[model samples]
Target chain A: MLAAAVRLFNERGYDATSMFDIAESLGITKSSVYHHISGKEQLLQMAMDRALDGLFEAADEVRALDVPAPERLERLVRRSVLVLAERFEYVTVLLRVRGNTEAEQHALSRRRDFDTIVTDLVKQAQAEGGVRPDIDPATVARLILGMVNSLTEWYRPRTGGAEAIADALTRIAFEGLRTE
Target chain B: MLAAAVRLFNERGYDATSMFDIAESLGITKSSVYHHISGKEQLLQMAMDRALDGLFEAADEVRALDVPAPERLERLVRRSVLVLAERFEYVTVLLRVRGNTEAEQHALSRRRDFDTIVTDLVKQAQAEGGVRPDIDPATVARLILGMVNSLTEWYRPRTGGAEAIADALTRIAFEGLRTE
Candidate 1:
């Protein structure tokens, strides 16, 4: 039911989709849909939680490592890519969020918290002489993660393995495309 | 009028927005809007054209430059960043397009053509021994431009100059964020 709701939310904008539409799509009564969740808002919150929780869990694991910031950043990127692949629909919906509702605003705030984690890591990497310091840490964090987030747009999990994509991303990200 | 339409489309999803809402947003009657354009679809086409044309123009300029493939690729990236900064709104809408309509499908096709240009550049650079050959050209192209297209989500032109962003991107993209 949640998957069907998310699918509808992704295809039709969240604001445009209603509880009745979700019910009809599922071939179930709207009250039965209500039995599972209070409203579509709850469904949205649950969907976003799936994506955010996966990301935060990855962050938690990477943070526990005693490795250098750059290495941790790389691992986080790879793990996040796996999370994105695993929870494709939820992440897609999360990325499309515009923060109009309370649930969306909450998700947006969590996303900011995630960005701060990346930014702090970038600053640490720069201090450790792994990342370049000339550019702002915030910009570096955004661009690097932006590349990862772009996967949600074009990446199809069935087409290729997330591991290969992650390897390609980290290689391009840290070493760049230029041949030494 | 088209600008207002694009703004509305960006705020509200294109499928959800109506000609009436657009006319109301502009403080004009729907018929008056029709006087200028046949329908909202035309406005969408015009807006997408603004972004696609600018990008293609930059590509054409870079194609004429007598430089190595990698340098040409760098120049195209820089120029494309400027185009995104200049036509921020249109590009934002263009990036959000999921090919729901005829205009969107046309825009998506043009976007693919643009990607092919970048992919070809990547291939040429690899053949010239400037770019790393291990990674696939198409993946490299997507990741590079994906970082750029992300500017639409967080980049506010008023915050900083596009040149600085371009320089930072190319530097990170070429030499990478890591310091030797």
Candidate 2:
């Protein structure tokens, strides 16, 4: 039911999508939707939480790893792309949250927390001489995550799958674009 | 006036912002706004076009340069970041267009054209042995542009300025993130 709401919200703008539309797509009455979920806002929150929870869990697992800082960072990026690809609809909606409602505002705040976590990891990686130290860790974090987040916009599972995209992202991000 | 509109639209969102709010913010009458532009939608269109024009012009200038493919690609990325920072609000509004309206749909198509232009440049660079050929050129293009485009979300003119960010982006993008 949440999946149907996400698809409808993604297909039509969240503001444009209605409870009636979600119910219709799910082959249930509006009352059924109300019985199952509090409201459309609740559904949006649930979907965003689903996506954010996956990312936060991945970050935690990577942080718990005994690997070096750079390796941990790499794993986080790889895992993020994989999670995003696997939960494409959820993450897509999560990324597009513009803070119009309380739920979206919560999602935005949590997204920033996730960014700070990545930034701290980047700083650690730089200090350990794994990642480059010249650029500000925050900037590096934003750029790296930006590259990963962009997957939500253009990635299609049919094209190359998550592993292929993840490999390309890790390679391009860690290695320079130059042939040398 | 359009600058003010772009700022307001960026802050309050395009749908929420009204012509009256734009006028009130500008300390002008609503009639004065109508005298200059058709409506709020026109302001959005004008602002987006301003951004797209700058990008297209930069691409054209870079293409005309007699530099190597790698250098050409670098210049395009550098110039794009600079333009994005300089025209921050316009580009911000431009990037957020979701194609709900005719104007937005037009912006989306033109944005795709710009992406194709950059992707072709990456492909040429790869064929010329300038960029690494390991990843597909299209994927490379998307990642690079994604890194650059993320600037709109967090960049502040009072912070590093356009030149500094451009230099950092060029260095990181061309030289990779890992320290040798």
Candidate 3:
């Protein structure tokens, strides 16, 4: 039922989706949905919470590693792609939120927290004088994530294989866009 | 009125918006809206079309120049950030569309055309031995765009300075995560 709601919300969007529509999608009663969850708000919260858990947990793992920043950041990118692939719909919903609702604002805040962790890693890498010093660490973090996050926007799970996507991202990200 | 619609759609969403609500926001009647455009579909198409025009034209200008590939790419990035800042809401809508409508599919096709143009440039740069040879040009094109496109998700025209944003993006994208 929850998966059905997430799919509908993702497909039709959150506000455009109604409880009745969700009920129809699941072939269950709206009351049955209420029995499973308090309301639509709770459903969004639950789905967002699950998505955040995967993302922030990846951040935590990246932070726990006491390696050089590049290696750590590479792991961050790889782990992120893995997580994005695993929880595709949930993370897609999380990324597509526009912060119009309190639930969305909460999700946005959590996303910012994760962004900050990546920013710190970029900063650490910059401080080591290994990464380019010309760019803002925060912007670099966003740049890395933008590539990874865009995967959700286009990648079909079966097309070109998962490892291929991960490999392409890792190479483009870690290596400078220079012929060497 | 279009501004209000863009603002509202960006704030809420495209599908969630109605002509009634748009009319309400502008203190005008539904008939008054028809005086301007046919309906929501035309409005969305116009807005997105303008945004695409600016982007592809900039890409064309950069391509026509005799500058080095990397420099051309930088100018391309700068121009892109300008469009994102200038056509903020329309581009935001264009980026967020899921291709559920005919107009949306057109927008997506145009977007693909733009990507292909940029990808060809990346291929040229790589072949010239300017960019990394191993990474796919398509992925690199997307990665560069990933930085600029992300600005829509967070950039506020009034709050954020366009030059700084553009410069930061250019620096991050070209120089990369390592401190040189």
Q: Candidate 3 on B27-131: residue-level lDDT in tens?
A: 999999989989998888888898899999999899899988867876887899999899998899899888989999999999999888888888888777767
lDDT of 2 by residue, B100-147 (tens): 999999999999999999899998998898798888888888888888
The number of clashing residue pairs in each candidate reads 0, 0, 9
Predicted candidate 1 versus true structure: per-residue lDDT over A1-180, tens digit per residue: 999999999888788899999999999999999998899999999999999999999999999999998889889988988899899999999999999998999999999999999999888988988778999999898988898899988999788688888899888888887885
Query: Global lDDT for candidate 2?
Result: 0.89
Q: Which segments of candidate 2 are over 4 A away from where they belong?
A: A158-160
Please list the C-alpha lDDT of all candidates, in the order they appear.
0.91, 0.89, 0.82
Separate DockQ for every predicted complex? 0.78, 0.68, 0.50
Chain B of candidate 1 achieves a TM-score of 0.95
lDDT (10s digit) by residue, model 2, range A95-145: 888888888999999999999999999999999997989888888888888
The better-scoring model by TM-score among 1 and 3 is 1
lDDT of 2 at B135: 86
Worst 10 residues of 1 chain B by lDDT: B171-180
lDDT: worst 10-residue window of model 3 chain B: B171-180
Q: Give the top-scoring candidate (DockQ).
A: 1
Candidate 3 ranges with C-alpha deviation above 4 Å: A19-33, B27-29, B68-70
